[model samples]
Every structure is written in structure tokens, then in C-alpha cells.
Target chain A: MIAALLESFAAAARGLPLTLAIWGAGVATGLALGFVIGAVRFFAPAALSWPLAAVVEAVRGVPFLVQCFLLYFGGPFIGIDLTPIVAGWVALSVYGAAYFSEVFRAGFMAVPPGHLEAARMLGIPRNQAVLRIMLPMMALAVLPSLANLAVILIKETAILSIITVPELTFRVQGVGSATFAFAETTLVLALVYWALVEATAVASRHAERRIARALAA
Target chain B: MSAPILSVRALERRVGDVEILRRIDLDVMPGEAIGVIGPSGSGKSSLLRCIAGLDEVSGGAVMVEGRQTRPGDGAVGMVFQQFNLWPHLTARENVALALKLVRRMPAADAAAKADAALARVGLGALGGRKPAALSGGQQQRVAIARTLAMEPRVLLFDEPTAALDPELTTEVLDVIRDLAAAGTTMLVVSHEMGFIARLSTRVVFLDHGVVVQAAPPAALFGAQAEPRVRSFLQTYLDRVAWARDA
Candidate 1:
């Protein structure tokens, strides 16, 4: 069992690049879309904000796995010939974007009314005020939340294995099926994921401490 | 006589269902410092907000230097009650941000101007520090520096030292007095009777969103005061005196 666990760990390590690629692509796309959605929600009129809110609510209510499966298996019927990897990336990006938008919106709301008033009284244009004064403050406020989202995105990459994307989880499953060593392979995969989460948590803690010190100064 | 730097005529404002300010008429001449005094929630801050073009006036106009403030035109600078310095920006950067973003001043020139403004507010050495690094009085000075860098024709201050300790309050008030001495056209909303007494050329007393009296600070606080004004001043003076003692 020890030997089987070591072999499974090696297989998973071989798929690290694929795992990282999915996570990277998904986060990049999600962040872009999230900024747009968050801005629209913040500045749009009630008529617009309500519909956007409904869309965000609907997306958040659904399970991510179901969304991935629907996109990967159902795309062919719509005449969009997406490979399983492409489908998984697109699904995860869309799902993650919805969650990220809410996070950004909350950060934007945290900015005080007085800051904006000060900018206006200085004769700063509204758009310029938002770019210079508001965005930087929002970025600092949202950094911790973004770091947590990064960890979630990394773990969610494991779900892409359901679409046969040949990631860490997929390699673990393949090794288990080949050698009939389910317990060892699954345990090793769990350990790998635990290690990844632990590393992410440590990085986030360091980032928060840095931010706190900066704020204190 | 020279034209007033800021003029407001019959300004009316309503927030949701409640009227916040009503029939507010004011004219501030160049180089004059006007003190606005009232009880809490008497709409002094709201009136200042309207004059600074930070709030919409439901039924009046604010004119600065003969140009009426519209949605796009920039005219006035304001210092808030809470010292709204951009937390992420250093003192110099916070002041420079307005010059760069609004006036489109050259980066070096804006930085120089920001430094000068900070120096004027007695915060020359603290220019590199962020608001979180500064004490409350220091932050208020930075806020004043930011407004001064804008070089607006009219400067509006909303309860500038309301949130500071007495010692810190004196620091902020000193900067404001210096601005007045330099002939900046200022409208200050404050509860500090001493500041109003020493700095104001004229004092406007407001109550329930209306001006009850407009006179020289001495006259308003003297035996010539209206009955309501005298009653209000008595309560205000007593409270401030007690606060100082405590």
C-alpha cells in the first residue's frame, strides 16, 4: 500500500501543469468578468441592478459540478464543439466570476461616502475619482477575500477531472483503477489536496499580516 | 466692492421624505470667513454639502466666482467632519491626487504643490505617512492640505474638528485660523464657540433647517442675541465649558 501510494503521488505530480493551467485560466477569465459585472451592479440603475442580482443569485444557487457537467455534455447539442478541457475551463470561469463579482461589490460598498465627497469637492471628475481614489482603496480592502477565492479556485480545479481533463484528481483515479488500490490512491490524493490548501492558507496569513502592518503604519 | 466668491439663493434640499435644508440664502465675499453654527442635526452640514456641490439642491443654485456649479463644472473644495483622507494614500499623495486627477497638473508640479500645502498645514515631515499612521489632528491637517491644493475659490468645512480630542482639536483649528488669516474664502460649520468667536467675520445660526439669525459672531453671542439664539448659546457654551473642564 505504501508503494502504491508513492506511485499515485508521482502520477499526480506529473499532472501538475494541467492542474495549474486550469486554475490559472479560470481565475484570469473570472477576474476580468467579475470586475465588469461588479461595476455594472454598483453603478447601474435599479432596473439593471435587479436583473443582475437575479442572475448572480441563480448562478450561486446551482452546484458547480452540475454546471460543469451540463456545459461539457450539453454543448454538443448546441453545435459548439468544445473539448472537455475547454468546457471545464469555461464552466469554472463563469461560476467563479459570479462569486468574485459579489466579493468585489462588497469591497466597493465599503468605501465611505466622505471619500467620494472629498474627491468631488476637489473638482475631480467622477470617473477619475473612482479610478484613483476608489479603486485603490477597494483593492486593498478586497485582497484577503481574493486570496481566499484563489484557494477555492485551485481546489475547484480538481472538479475538472469529471470531464476527463487529466488533472491531479484524474491521475489519482486512473492509478487507482489500474492497480485496484482504491484506498491508497484516494488517501494520497486527499493528502495532496490538504497540502495545497495548507500552503494557500499560510500564504494568505502572511498577506493579511503584511496588510495589517501597512494599515497600522 | 468685489463680487462674492460663493453665492447661494433660496437653496432647498430634501432627502427622501424629510427636508434637510430650506430656503438657505448665503453669499460669501472673497477673503471672508463665515461660521455656521447650530445644534446637532440642524442641517448645517447639509447646507455646507449643498454649497460644496456634494449634495443636490432641490430648488436653488450655488454660484462660485460668477459660474454656477453644474453637474460637470468644478468650483469648490470641502473638508469633511471625519477628515476623509484617502487611507491608502500618503499625505502628499492624497493632496496631489486632487491636482493630478482634477486640474491635470504635471506630476512634479502637483507633488511640489502638495508638499507646499502640507507644509502650510504644519505637516511637512508627515507628508510621507498615510492617514492610518497619523493621529486624528494630523489627518485633519492632511485633509485641509488636500483641499488647499485644489485652490478652490471657496472652501467649505463641515464640523472640521468635531471628532478630535481637545488638544487635537486645537491643532486643526489652528490650521483653519491660518487659512482664514491668509484670506481664504471659507464657510466653516463647527460647534466650537471659541473658534467661531475668534475666526468668523459673520455667524449664521441655523435651526430646524432654517436660519434663525445671521450676524457677527460677537453680536450673536452677545446681549443683542435673539431669545432663541441666547438660549442656544447658553446651552452650547455650558456644554463646551464642561467638556473642557472634564
Candidate 2:
């Protein structure tokens, strides 16, 4: 049993870097795309906003796992063949962006309209007002929600293994099949995810306190 | 004698089918302070907003210092009832932000000017605090300092003391009173009867979005006042007396 556990652990460790790579890339791209989506939905005119809204709703309504399959498998039929890793990354980023946009849009609405008016009255440039005043206010108002989405994105990366991406779940599953240590491998995998999520929460709390102190000072 | 520092010509503000203000004309000479008083929804705030170019006029013009003014024209500064300071920023940063962004001042220079402006409002030592950390009065004073640092051609106040307690209102009024004494051109929309009476060079009473009476404080508040103006003052006095008796 110890031998089986060690083998499972080794396999899981081998897949760790790839899992983290996909998650980090997904988050980086998702955040950039999501910010644009949210701003357009909130501030753009109806002609431009409606189409983006439809796309966001369609992406959000679909299950992320199905999106992974549709992109990885169905792409070749449409002359857009993507490798498993590329397919998984794209699917995950788009999925995460859809949800993250909602969080940002809500945060935008939560900020006081008076703040922007004050900025404009003071002669601050429009772009500066949005960047320096509006975005920071929205981010501060919705920090916890953004952090929560980030944690959720990390876990969602596990689903990427279904498309044959060699991530933690894929490696652990291989170990389970080879050594028949399904229970041991799966248990360790659960613990790994739990640790990552807990770390994210603690780091979020630390960042929040630092920001509060900066604001007060 | 000097050209009017600010001019509003036939200002009209219509929201959908409702005409909130119509054909309002006003002028403020250099060193003159105008007090605007009226009942709620009589377009008192709208007039100030129009002059500051913060709100669009349906059919009118706002010219400050001989140029047509628009938002971000840097022609006017406004202090709001809520003292709309960015809650995340310190008082000094609040005062310096526009200077850095709009005036394109060096950060260090802007900081120095901000500190000086804060000192002018008697908040010299409290510039490091955020709005949340200060009293309602201090926050408004910081707001005044922020606007003063910009040195706009005209200053606009829309119910600057309405959000404060009586004690807190006194501190904000003191700052405005000083500004008036220094001959700053200003248009104040206020309910503080005593402050407006004492500080305004001329008082403009608005009703139903038009100027009902415009005169010096002595005439506007004296026994020989406009009947509409007298009734308005009477209503205010009645409320004060009722509150005291209660």
C-alpha cells in the first residue's frame, strides 16, 4: 500500500507544473478579456453591447466541460484544428471570462455615479477618470468576488484532463489504472485542490488588509 | 465695472417631456458671490450645475472668463452636498489627483500645493486621513481644498452644508465665508439662510425654474421682500420654530 501511495504521489507531482501553467495562463487571459467584456456591457451603446451580451450569455450558459470537448473535437471539422492543450486553454479562458465579466459588471454598477461626476468636474481626463477612479473603485468593491472566481478557475483546470491534457488529474488517473490505487490517488488529488484553494483565500485576505491600510494612510 | 466672470444665457434643462429649467439668464461679475435659494425641485441645483457645465443645458450657453465652458474645461469647481471625495484616497491625494491629471503638475509639486490648500481650509494637519477617517465637516473641508487647489474661474456649491449636522455645518460655512470675504466669484445653492444672507453679495431667488427675484441680501431678506420670497422665508422660520418647540 505504501508503494502504491508513493507511485501515485510521484505521478501527481509530475503533472503539477502543467496544471499550474494552464491555470495561470487561463486566469491572465481571462481577466484581460473579462474586463473589456464588462466595460462594454456596462458603458457601451446598445448597438455594440447587445452582441457582446449575447456572446457572454451563450458562453456562460454552456457547461465548461462541453465547451472543452466542442472546441477540441469539433474544431477540425470546421477547419480550426487546435491541439488539446490549446483547446483546453482557450475553452477555459472563455468560460472564466464569461463569469468574471458578470462580477465586474456588477461591481461597476455598485460604484457611486457621483464619483465620476466629481472627477469630470475637477477636469480629470475621461480616460484617467475611468482608469484611476472607476476601475479601482470597482475592483475594491468586488475584490472578494474576483478572488472567489480565481479559486474556482484553479479547480476548473482539473476538467481540462478530460480532453487529454497531461495535468494532475490525468497523471493521477494513469497511476490509479496502472497500480489499482484509485482511492489513494483520488484522495491525494482532493487534498491538493483543497490546499490550493485555501492558499488563495489566505492570500486574498492579506492583499485586502494591505489595500485597506494604504487607503487609510 | 469688470466683465462678468461667468455668464449663463437662456439656460433651459428639459428631461424628457418635463422642463426642469427654462430660459434662465444670469451673470456673475468678478468678485461677486450669488446665492440661489428655492424650494426642492425648483431647479436651484440645476442652475448651478448648468453654470458649472457639469450638466448639459437643452438650450443655453455657459461662458466662463469669455470662453464657452464644458466639462473638463477647468473653468469651474464644484463642492457637492455629499462632499464626493474618493474614499480610497487620502485628503492630500484627493486634492492632488486633478492637479496631476488635469494640470499635468509634477507629483511633488502637486502634493505641496495640495498641502497648502488643505492648510487654507484649517485641515493642515489632517491631509493624511481618508474621508472615512474624518468627520463629515472635515471631509467637506477637504473637498473645498481640493477644488480651491484647482483655481477654477468660478466655484459652485450645491447644498454644501445640507448633509452635515448643525455643528459640522458651521465649520464648512466658515470656509465658504472666508472664500467670499476673499472675493472669490461663486454661485451657492444653499438652504442655510443665515450663511447666504451674510455672505452673498447678491441673492437670486428661483421658483419653478425661473428667477423670481434677484437683489442684494438686505433687500431680499428685509421686510419689503418679494411676497413669494417672504413666504419661503416664513416657511423656513416656521420649521425652525417648530423644531425648537418640539
Q: TM-score, chain B only, every model?
A: 0.94, 0.96
Model 1 lDDT per residue over B113-142, tens place: 999999999998888898988999999999
Model 2 lDDT per residue over B1-246, tens place: 788889888999999998989899888999899999989999999888888777778998888888998876778999998898998889999999999998999999999999999999999999888888999999999999999999988999999999999999999999999998998999999999988999999999999998889999999989768999999999877887998999
Off by over 4 Å in 1: A204-217, B71-74, B239-246
Q: Estimate each model's TM-score.
A: 0.94, 0.93
Interface RMSD of each: 2.7, 1.7
Chain A TM-score, each candidate: 0.92, 0.94
User: In every candidate, how many clashes are there?
Assistant: 0, 0
Once model 2 is optimally superposed onto the true structure by TM-score, how far is the C-alpha of residue B179 displaced, in angstroms?
0.6
Which 10 consecutive residues of model 2 chain A have the lowest summed lDDT?
Answer: A208-217
Per-prediction DockQ comes to 0.58, 0.67
Clashes in predicted model 2: 0
DockQ of 1: 0.58
Candidate achieving the largest DockQ = 2
TM-score of chain A of 1: 0.92
